[model samples]
Target: MDSDELSEKQNRGVAARIREELARRRVSRQYLADLAKISLSTLEKALSGHRPFTLATTIRLEEALAMRLRVSETLDNVAAISNGHADEQFGAYSRASVAWIEGLYLTVRPSFGDRQAIFAYCTEIHWNEAASNLRFNEKDRLDAAFTQQGTVSIPNLSGHIYLSTNTSGQQRLIIVSRPSITGEMYGILTTLQAGRGAQLTPVAAPIVLIPMKALADAPLGRINPDQPGFDAYAAYLKRTVEEPFAMFLPGVAAP
Candidate 1:
């Protein structure tokens, strides 16, 4: 495809994703533009995918909205379509289902609990029986661990991570937007109450594999957890986590 066609396709995909996210949050275009610190026209272009969001633009939006912002390079390449891996392309048609499911999770799941939301990750993308009955007190455990050890650094960035949940009561939903390489920065929930862990199930959203150690650093103040530094994290993903993961936990598979 020509440059115009490629840009058009990417723009359409990004626009769809942004619109869905905005609708989920019930925010308007002008509000988003203001938060992103961009002119309305610029915001429109970025959403349209004619302009891939620069690191600064994304950071501004994340802070203004107080929501997670992420970009998966594995999912960003527009060439994937012409290369015939259309399923992996960055377009509305390619990600429609995943975005819809994620939108649902973002909107519907928040009402289920009041615990501090934490986004946790596993070495593998899929869950195994060993972790099936596992009760994770995401923030509580991570906080305690951090207090004692300083901070944990996660090494992976694009393979798999998860939210904390329970059976009787739901803890906060840890939404892992991106993985940290040397810091503990993550999108965190406001409050964390003692609650039950959600049973492991099919992930409704795209999973970004992250290293466990990086997560430790962000919460412990070793790095700036703000959205502006996300590109640094993304850089980690491109260099490290996109491929060459360690051994898989037994019985785990990509869902």
Candidate 2:
């Protein structure tokens, strides 16, 4: 085919992949647009075949989805490199072995901004074929701009699951126990808390992950004390401490 025809075909392929991902993840187009830092109209036009996706827009979408849409000659080699590194780092667990953990969870934690409120969001865990490991992404967050996506590590020896994000040198971590009989995971989350005047403070808080399927028609986002499910959500977060899923140590003077 001619160059224009090849480009058009490629655009159609990328658009199809994007649509598939949106359906698979059950994410709204507006959410994807926000995550990709693109205007909704632009994404709509591109998806509708009225406008071709620019290289920059395609890259942004790929990063937002944490998956590749465009085919590259070196794609296999890149996947092999990622798989090799991830296998060693994430305990080499095969997709079948960790299949049970691949689903949506209602992630709950103490709100950083409100002492008496709980922040709720949706988290999706799925196997990354290219990376040969499990991956996770947080969505439906009130603070959507700060949403996180990262690799999941499940080490057999520790018997704990870790969701960690590393950008540049900064890192955010969540360590949770294995799923309970009811499919709830309790844990602690460690990340930088934004303070006044561009200041950031190191902070950690208890967190809980409940299977989305278990919470039928429950509200997400921020749950305050007066909210309907606040009490239950608070109880789940408290499990991270009461069950002793994680411990907090006070600082001691150097010896």
- TM-score for each model: 0.26, 0.73
- Summarize candidate 1's per-residue lDDT along 1-255 as a digit string, tens digits: 433322444445445656765654455798668645679987877775556666566556544433324424356443432332212211212222222112111111111132222232222121111111111212222223211000111123443323443222323343444334432223322224333584443222222334443353332111223434344544443343245222223465655
Candidate 2's TM-score reads 0.73
lDDT of 1: 0.35
Computed on alpha carbons, the lDDT of every model, listed in order, comes to 0.35, 0.83
- Candidate 2, residue 35: Cα displacement in angstroms equals 6.0
Minimum summed lDDT over a 10-residue window in model 1 is located at: 146-155
**Weakest 10 consecutive residues, lDDT, candidate 2?**
1-10
Tell me each candidate's RMSD, in Å, in order. Answer: 19.0, 4.8
Choose the strongest candidate by TM-score.
Answer: 2
